[model samples]
Target: MDIREDLRDVSGQIARLLALSNVFAENNKYWAHLKNDEDFNRVYRIPEKDRYKVESIYADGRDMAIYMMDALAEINFNYARYPTLTSIIEGFQNTWVYGNYNKETPDIAKEICSTYDIDLWSVRQMFKLFKDQEKLLAAVRATLAMLQNSNLYKEENGMPTQEKHPHQINLTGINSSSININSDGASAAVNQTYNEPAVFSEIITAIKLQGLDPIIEGELIDNTHMLAAGHKSGTFKDAYIDFMQNVSAHITVFGAFLPALSALL
Candidate 1:
């Protein structure tokens, strides 16, 4: 048995494992951020004199990534079910860097919510608007506020599940003073005044902050992405049509505004 061949085979396996991990990371937009190229060079402190040490550092990284992805997949699967408080979160032990989840939603998600006495359907609806963790959390805070303010959902003790005030909307850093929802469910009314004139820069900033990637000028741009126009009413009209037809958010505030605006026009 050639020992050199065995060493080469081991190196190849490590390389292959690392390559697959990278592909998965990219495909999922999963930024593991385990460490960057410079960090590896600095930590290992491999001198230029010993070129062979490079493979050793890479092999170590390969092993670390394998473990990181494994943990991330497990955690993400758990979060996929969300809207429920899980003891699993307590058990987690994150290191300096945090792992992201992007795995097939576990079959137990529904069951997990059921176990926690969480409303599965409502949770789904929440996720429909708030896709990521941060927004989801903010929305949760807002929903609890709605529930508490509704004068409904009272336990025998008569305590509130959601506290009043601290109501957040869109949570993209715009906490408008006028936007208030104290009613119940979708019918909950937002009773406030809007004397502040619409500032173009503010609207544009808000859109960009959402990472909506708005196109300002008319171009042969793909109709899929949301586009804004300075001129060419045709392009604007086309984009609006595409958005309305594809995005079924009629229940959303912005969605409701579209039809209302159309009627007014």
Candidate 2:
């Protein structure tokens, strides 16, 4: 069988599963309040016909989660040709899927917030944004498309191909700090001192313009803040590059600000 086609099909299935999970979560806000089957059945009184809806949603989510895990494993088996795509899927699995699928929504939120050092409200907003923007789904589809094109080029030429660097954005006259794209196609390098705060502000503003609130939809803001903090703490440039790579993978809308953020490196 053609592994690339299989990967593409599985990725599409993952997108549909994610959309289903998002819809289930949105419609059942009370899912957050219950902890287990006992709690679920005890907390609410519904007609007999609808009694199984919540249970069914959880069961379906768990089954889909398992399917996603298997798909990622299949992708991982071909990691040499698709390292970037594998990393993106792995990140999504670890952060959003994995052990959280069968659990209550609050449990999922708690785990994410504790791991990322963000708040519960931000977690909820992030999920809402996930549903509205379908960012992760878009990222998976784009990465798969890139991989397929790369494969076609390789096959036609009968030559192995190197992975391309992440897309770079160049900003001129921006405080003399610039990330110069390498002529050899390596990742860019920061050359001068730039206004880090302004760059972060611009990114936050860009996120807010997408109809997210500073206080409510704070997950993206928190992530941007962490990136800023990492720079201030003298973290290496590679860390920022890695973060931006993941950001670009997930949120295509923030493409314009990548260079500014990369400049902080």
Candidate 3:
């Protein structure tokens, strides 16, 4: 076997895997930190060498948790300077160096988060996001694998090449904050203010009892993934219409937003 060509094929599979993982990292609340942890620590991002050794272990369920933690630590450290996400964005630096996630800057992330008293709760949130993202990631990975096995792409050096799938959406960096699901538009409410959902749920019930048809937004059971009321639109029919139209234009856009998937996953 031509090792280079064989490795190329494997690399393609890995890239697709990473892409799916990336989507999960973006969509699923838990995976976001995990994914961020992975993304932020790329080899180039490391200021000092010989800190982290990035390797591809088996892409199995057992390793998922570990990967997620890695990304969480990476993000906390990278974003330590700013208190808010917006401030971090405004002062964004190219820490991800060529998209390589290798360990660097020994205990740098730990030191930074420690200074701010940021604990593993941040990692916990990412795990919550992972729940939903996992489903979509699995679906996409299966689809890609099926295509590759069926010879969908042109073979060069006997490796599967990237193909433009009809349902492709660049979900690499999209986050819960990126999409605005407010009570004014959709019945879906995204609440991030409270640490516990029971309190929020009681508040929501009280609001609903008032006949406001309020859509509450906040961290759901998983704590990382954002959950809203089902897509019923309730008193917000106009928001529902807009949501439907947007979905019709590009369903993949809403793939990550479905309450059904969120509920089941």
Best by TM-score: 2
lDDT of 1 by residue, 75-115 (tens): 32344432222222223334212223322222233334445
| TM value for model 3 | 0.21
Per-residue CA lDDT of model 2 for 117-226, tens digit only, reads 53334334334433322333332333333333454435445668666555454444356555543223332232234234577667768777777545434556544654
Residue 53, model 3: lDDT of 21
Name the regions of candidate 1 deviating beyond 4 angstroms: 1-24, 27-52, 76-87, 94-265
| Candidates in order: C-alpha RMSD to true structure | 23.3, 13.1, 18.6
Stretches of candidate 3 above 4 Å error?
1-4, 7-13, 19-63, 67-127, 152-265
Give a tens-digit lDDT track for model 3, residues 1-265.
Answer: 1212322433333233333344334344433344456443343333344222211211122245344324422323344543332332233223221112332222344444344454444333333433333433333323233323433233532566566443222222233332223323334333344233343244334333444222222111111111221111121222233223323533443444444332211
lDDT, candidate 2, residue 158? Answer: 68
| Residue 195 shift from truth in candidate 2, angstroms | 23
Question: All candidates' TM-scores?
Answer: 0.21, 0.36, 0.21
Better of 1 and 3 by lDDT: 3
Question: Which residue runs does candidate 2 get wrong by more than 4 Å?
Answer: 1-44, 78-134, 152-175, 180-265
Q: Find the number of clashing residue pairs for candidate 1.
A: 0
